[model samples]
Target: MSAAQLVLDLALTVRHDGRGGVADDLEDAEGLTAWVAAHTAELAEAAALPDPLAPFTADPAALTAVRDLRRAVRTLFARAVRPAPPSPADAERLLPADEALDRLAAAAARVPVAPRLTWPEPGPAELTYRPAAPAPPVDLLVSGLARAAAAFLASDDRDRLRACHAPRCVRYFLKEHPRQEWCKPSCGNRARVARHQRRHRADAL
Candidate 1:
């Protein structure tokens, strides 16, 4: 995944539970491990994270750090959407904007980065900065997530970020088109059903 996508996906980890409530994918070690496995390859490639000899396992501390970053990310996503409601998972208790920004900045700073020059046999030379030697898997992951969030927020795509408010769904998504409403067809269907139910109840009244 591109860095932009990582931030959005991280914020969306808090989503609709099958039983109609909020569920957090980072609630425990198992869930966090699974989520990282699923997204790690793409993100690692994008961020130049080191490949591990054994599969990466998330520990309690990693879980706390990642969840902390997610809160900040969600808070910023809420701010990006302006007057529109944010995803309901933590809408009522989002971190303060300044705090959220600080969290992201701190996570990204955990790893030291230095600029290096690169030249290809067939390409022109370019100067680029790579993250210095690998940190612990969890630290690198969190730092990468924070960096991705910062990049996304500073890019044009941030303007398209939005919260999905369909029944039982709490997600943030990009606006694909002018008429796009919910995050997907299913959410749109649910929203229509909800609208219909509201109208029917109103008519009976």
Candidate 2:
């Protein structure tokens, strides 16, 4: 797994939670921690790649960097649903998600590549050399994740993405089925019960 793959995996996980409703807070820190832990093996596999440039070692520092980057990504997604007015501290605390994607794109562009070359040879013989394109970098992965988020946020097609209406389950999910709601049926049931209770109380009054 490359850094790019790790980021993409995180993107999918983040999108999974966005199904019910946009999470407005890190209300379930335990859940978040568990999610991160579950992905650790995948992250380790991705971290095995060689360093991006010379003088950079892919060691503990790289692992730490990836973890920090993922954490930042989580925070950005959390903030998107419940944005607070930008304070100086807020700006300093987290990388703006769009900016992070842009940075990733820029980094991806900087990856070295060998251009294809062709040479004419005598008597209709020709020689050519072409370099294989490098695999996508982490930045491109980040950009893709950002695009997915944007699509979910901006699209009017309710069928593509939806927020879980279940109480306290503010997660987003893709609507794979026409009747799907609340990411899981459990949440749906909870929502129905809550609704029923509210209506019952109202009728009593």
Candidates in order, TM-scores: namely: 0.92, 0.40
Q: How big is the positional error of residue 143 in model 2, measured in Å on the Cα after superposition?
A: 8.9
lDDT per residue, candidate 2, 1-205, as tens digits? 4344444345344332444433321224444344445545543343322233212223343333344444454444445434323212223456777765554444334333344445566445443222134443343222333333333333443234444556656344445777776667887898899999999999999
Q: Report every candidate's CA lDDT.
A: 0.84, 0.43
Best by lDDT: 1
TM-score of model number 2: 0.40
Q: Give the lowest summed-lDDT range of ten residues in model 2.
A: 48-57
Each candidate: RMSD: 1.8, 10.5
* Model 2 stretches astray by more than 4 angstroms: 1-159
Candidate 1 residue lDDT tens string, 1-205:
7777878878878988889788888889888889888886766655545567128798899899999998999999999998898888776879999999999999998877677788899999986555787678787888877877898899999999988888888889999899998999999999999999999999999
Report the lDDT of model 1 for residue 77.
91
